[model samples]
Target: MDQPRGVESAPVQQLLNLLVDRLDSAEQRGSAGVKSIALGERTWPALYMAHRESEKENLWEHIIELSCWGWLVVKPEVATRSRSGYADSPRVTVANILEVRKAVGRSTRIKSAVERWREAVREGLHGTDEVKAAVSEFCIDMPDRSMAEVVERLNVLPSLVGKELLLREVSSQLFWGMSKVLDKRQGLVAAVLGVDECPFPESPIQLQVFLPESGYHGVLFIENLMCFERAIRSKSSAFDGLALVYASGYKGGAQRLRTHDGCSLFYSTRGGFRQDLRASFEAWLFSKDVIPAFFWGDLDWSGMRILSVMRTTFLELAAWEPGYCQMLAALIGGNGHAPEAADKQGQKALDFSGCFYADTYLLPALHSYKKFVDQEQIRF
Candidate 1:
């Protein structure tokens, strides 16, 4: 468990960091370039990966340490070889980048999980049989997005997957949102071809989940849970014809589903947008151009960023201007503002030209006021 000093050295870290991106690119493109990282002594990858102070002798030592940790088996004897190793160098890649740290056990654990998940998916299994596979999807299929997070949270994944359909829930927005036709299967027999219940609420949602769900003509996403609960409470009147959902805070993401939705509604934050649900949400926009989707969040720098990020996906994502006006009026003396920190966060201060909210209103007013207006100001 302790990292060897040399292995922990800047040189080794630089080397690995360079390789990580390359490996990811290679894997995504289905290229053979990842088999071995070709690093010449004068090349940028090698120089960037090499430490400022490491000499040739010390460099080889680091390689040995990395090899000892199973990152790559090194062949340090040749000059034609890359800084990490030559094309035909004895140092062959022995494992994945994720496997480098826990060369002994974590690798095996992750490997087993991936294998189990592969088998489970193949067998159309659910529950414990399906949990590892879902996590494995994060670990493998969506590697760039979730591998590190999944690896860091692997121990908790099993229990988390027990009651929550983490993967499938994320699948629509994260993996299947771009779908024209639903291709996945859910539960024992349900394939996501039509109406289903939205899964954002921790409890049962009485509303249906497909696009243009019956009476709901539009969808509204709130950032906070209380707001979502409040919206849901308005089911019979004002909120009718609106599939209201909570964007699940800054940590919102796509759900992986065994069965995918035909048309999925996407909810995301600055942190979750394309990284989490951009594609799926975009697909929804592409499929249903008529449905109006609005994202309402607090009036702050982050809120602006959230709006900006959401706009990239749903160009129609507009400010709840009427509600925003009401929110400001209800404020003390109609004197409005965002947080102090938000005011100083210059990006928030910049006049967001061509903002969907009539360009000159709402956001500019908030910027001028320099104060926070919680969305909860408007009750259900």
Candidate 2:
């Protein structure tokens, strides 16, 4: 009963996957055929792999599920809820992390590496080198593709930015400026979706969504698909929107706004914007008279980056005003952690440094923690 009735949580499984690696690495020399580890209560090795507050919160509820799989053992005599005391030579193994998982509760997500990769390729993510690299580098050690860890590794790859190699159909220098810098483990990779000299449309483009028929104050662009879909359906003021666009995985869907009418504002769900998509945003902002545009994203470098992109160098954007700013300041002032951007696309921390003038004091304090504060958790 400890393991829930259906699918396991992605975050919990991710944690278990990481802990298994640690357990495997720390195995003793003269042990039996069984390879396992010992975990002390109130210690980090027993909890989330990430030492940050945000990650801690994610894996907090699955202690029982892990116990059920024998992946985690708790002393019946000790406070189980506390995840306290010590775990003796436990039976937990790498198999616990790699084993087939049941469809717990509402989740029917498949965690198999082969199956997932096949699905990914079918979904058009088969960019030869990327798919190969993801398999060889990430899954080679452990074929746990469903693990959130693998997903994060893939997200940061230049492939996620949807950039493709350009054939030398023209002078390479002319196409250089079209590239965007993407942060990677080795450093940064300059990504170019298409060479300017190539035929008609160089790359597949997702159009900016607009509800020209809907009456409203402004346009809201959300990073999360669920949230974007919910915005138009709900009449609640908290999620109310005149119109909305889904900026899927930082691929800003806000297309040419000049064709559409301006409202009170234009904003995003998460932080940061790429150069390839900035021109339309610029035109959207300065079209006629300056209309109000707002950006409400997670409280992290990435979110701030999106905000910086929205604010741009020419125009300044206010924090969800005195209210959002005050809330953000309170979180940062308290040392809210800024977890390294899981899939950071920008090469520099201050990718949009020009907007720093408005909130210079806020960045240093926020950046120090290097943690992420999800906007969905806080009640606005």
Candidate 3:
């Protein structure tokens, strides 16, 4: 695309110069390409101020002209808007670097970093079928990120890291400053690197399960640690045939049971004995004859939310009447603390948890009292 006539104003020329400078810097750093570079305070503060000052005089006519010329890509497609609506600043990036360079009379071609990164990726494609598939579809598209650094990380995958390592450990070894580079594209990283069986770092939150010695009848998910410890210590007759599982604030990992790796939860943490116990627990959890499930947590909105979330995995999960009844009695007697007192001011008031026990008895009590009682308050 050629530069349009009558759009060669000073501001427009200055903006074009800035784009060329950014492109040259990107080339030096081996970036794939820039995208969505905000033409605001962050990227071009000086230009932004100039635009603001010139607003009353030129009224962004230069921006419109450059955008109309196809030399710059303005967000919101402002080409269709009337002049009155162009008051606010829109994000802008070079639509075509070659055209911008030509317009600025600096048409020197530089080899793209994306092509180099792609070649490197292809060269390192000697892994399994899964790796090959992921690599073939891998894209070098993150804006302002170095493709060379990514290539270096990809190259180190074969020798630097071991199988079944945590994602954080790999990230730390890669030393990509605060960014969990491996964590983002897990499938690609896992396949290309053979770091773990599952693409993601296994859940660090372990489910502290106590399988009943007697025949299994049901399961109770305990939310807090103290309550879980208490349940194990008590060994009450009420929990005789029920398997007790400590929820451990699990929200996402529990949902993975419905996926291809139902047993991956067991394989998450290291150790053979621990793995065996988790396997047994997983098997019993997903048995054909659905076991009755119940949840016992704090009489607060967060607990209710956890129950509602975990219910997706444990279909029959509901509020445990025995525990909630105790909590409810405490709340009604004004034995509970206010939301602010308990640092629960941020907790949202949940009106439901998809359980008769919760909907019928628990939610109403919490809403009515606006108080919370921890599960640990109730002994057994």
Among all candidates shown, the one with the greatest lDDT: 3
In candidate 3, the residue pairs with backbone N, CA or C atoms under 3 Å apart (3 or more residues apart, or in different chains) clash, namely none
Which candidate comes out best when scored by TM-score? 3
lDDT of 2 by residue, 48-107 (tens): 345665544334435555566555554442434543222322233334443433222212
* TM-score leaderboard ranking: 3, 1, 2
lDDT of each: 0.48, 0.42, 0.67
Model 1 lDDT per residue over 278-325, tens place: 444344544534568776776655666676666655566776665566
- Candidate 2 whole-model C-alpha lDDT, 0 to 1: 0.42
Q: What are the per-model numbers of colliding residue pairs?
A: 25, 18, 0
Residue 322 lDDT in candidate 3? 88
Ten contiguous residues with the weakest lDDT in model 1: 186-195
Candidate 3, residue 80: CA error in Å?
24
Q: TM-score of each candidate?
A: 0.36, 0.34, 0.53
Q: Which whole-number lDDT from 0 to 100 does residue 359 have in model 3?
A: 88
